[model samples]
Target: MENRELILSIKDLQISFKTDSGTVSAVRGVNFELHKGETVAIVGESGSGKSVTTKAVMGLLASNAKIEQGSIYYTWNDFHTGEKKEVDLVKLSEEELQKEIRGQKIAMVFQDPMTSLDPTMTIGKQIMEPMIYHYKKSKKEAYEKAVELLQLVGITDAERRMKNYPHQLSGGMRQRIVIAIALSCDPYVLICDEPTTALDVTIQAKILKLIQDIQKKKDLSVIYITHDLGVVAKVADHINVMYAGKIVETGTTEEIFYDPRHPYTWGLLSSMPDLTTNSDELYTIPGTPPNLVKEIKGDAFARRNQYALNIDYRIDPPMFDVKGSDTHKVASWLMHEKAPKVEMPETLKQRIEAMKRGEEV
Candidate 1:
């Protein structure tokens, strides 16, 4: 296989928060890498730490959170030092990271435009903020570039929309403005935190396709944070299945959707409603995610897994290698040699087969 150029590398990463209740570990020993021009998605339910992990990458982790352990390294030519070095993102001072990296090198598009967008300012002013700060462009220059970006994201009334407020535009239009703002800086890596969560289904499809189109045109590496498996299947080149505060499984899109190994991953996939299913009721996985305040012992999913083995109660499963792709890995007792054959839910199996047949699933 041809080696893809590596852009971002995260290894043994852990992030914890010291709240009044207790220390809640949000990310635990998360390891993954992003290659140039590829979209990697962290898919899981709410409170799964998918958003937290990406926030760590963007240096946008909450004030209470601490980088407890591990390294998040990246290779980008320093405008100051004028040389490329493996910079540890976790080690960077807030001042240093904000001054050099954020928006200039690695930009992020937040989920809600209402929260991120400045209601008092025009869309044009908001989009130009990054350009003015990062590139030090004049107002005239920044507005011109902003207009171009608006058009690039398929906002037809670029000039009119640029003058509009967040409330005046539709949900889909606001999302495009957010994308335009993120792209204004010409970032090498774009972190999208549930970029289309608020939109309706049809608009979601268009927004997702717009992101794909933008990524292809710019050859930008992306970290997509989403809970929807359906969206992940369509947009992600690789999928990282997150649960509780750790990544339970990581694999190519096909490998994850078809040959899921972790119990948590199986549950996530199984819970997704099948539009093709003629059945009256939708499938659901049993139980809720564990509380992060307590010490997460063994496998976090063990309490909910029907097929969990004895070892899962005492020892946390280390990441195990899967065949074919050395990149494919799963943290589950099911991968151990002594474990019995536990098949995925038949619904998932049928869905995978349907996907292979190039049909809707």
Candidate 2:
């Protein structure tokens, strides 16, 4: 990945929302980078700030939301001049983002297709609007491209389906249409916010395959915001385990699954349903995430982490490089040299062994 071009870099991002009660710190010093032609999945429980961080990249934060610090640097090549360009997305105005970034250089496919698609508009027109608006293409050209896109997304009878409204299509078909719309202008980066969460398991598999295929065909970088670790095993090249608005662990897919270091990552991996397990009840992480409105003392996840040390309750831990791996990193007092060693649960060890043997766990 070092050789691949860096498409997006987020550094020290801090975001807050003003409520009637007080300000809620939504994102706290979050940092990550996306490379060209790779898929990075951000996984955690709801309200972990996964979607909020990506929304900032697209300039879609709510009016009450404020970015206290940080920069979202985007690097892309100019369409007309073929020159490399880089800009801080946070510094760009809303109008500037609309004209130059959104739907042109970067596009988003939301979780719910029904909400994303306009019920009043025809499918063809909805797909064509981005190209027509961004590239100033003639309606005829846009129409032709729209038909091609419909076919590319695996919708049958492309030209005929273009006339149908959102209600006429099935859930899976509507999601494909949303994907088609996101790719209408050939954007370099695609942010999928739980792209298949609204569909059934079978449909979710198909959508994941479709996105992976399109990524290979288009060489587009992708960011997946999801809580489903099963989905992460299938699609992610790298995984960022976010908890309480901060990334607690980051590593290659293999590292995070087979060599998890952080307690939160262990909890997440342990919660996955194992096929060979004898236990009837499913595992779950204990306790809820801490409220962000109040000032946090020490590690935010300490109250829920069974392996937490005394230092975890008194001081926050910095990101530490894992031993014998360059890609894996974790933030925990247990990673400190002086802290007592802790091991993951035995059941999780067995599950990992099953996975290593090429058996589904």
User: In TM-score terms, which candidate is top?
Assistant: 2
lDDT of 2 by residue, 14-89 (tens): 9999999789899999999999999999999999999999999999999999999999999988768999999999
Q: Per-candidate RMSD vs. true structure?
A: 1.7, 0.9
List the candidate 1 regions with Cα displacement exceeding 4 Å: 1-3, 78-83
Estimated TM-score per prediction?
A: 0.96, 0.99
Q: Global CA lDDT of candidate 1, please?
A: 0.87
Off by over 4 Å in 2: none
> Could you give me the TM-score of model 1 versus the true structure?
0.96
Can you write out model 1's per-residue Cα lDDT over 15-77, one digit (the tens) per residue?
Answer: 999999999988888989998889999988899888888788778888998999999888876
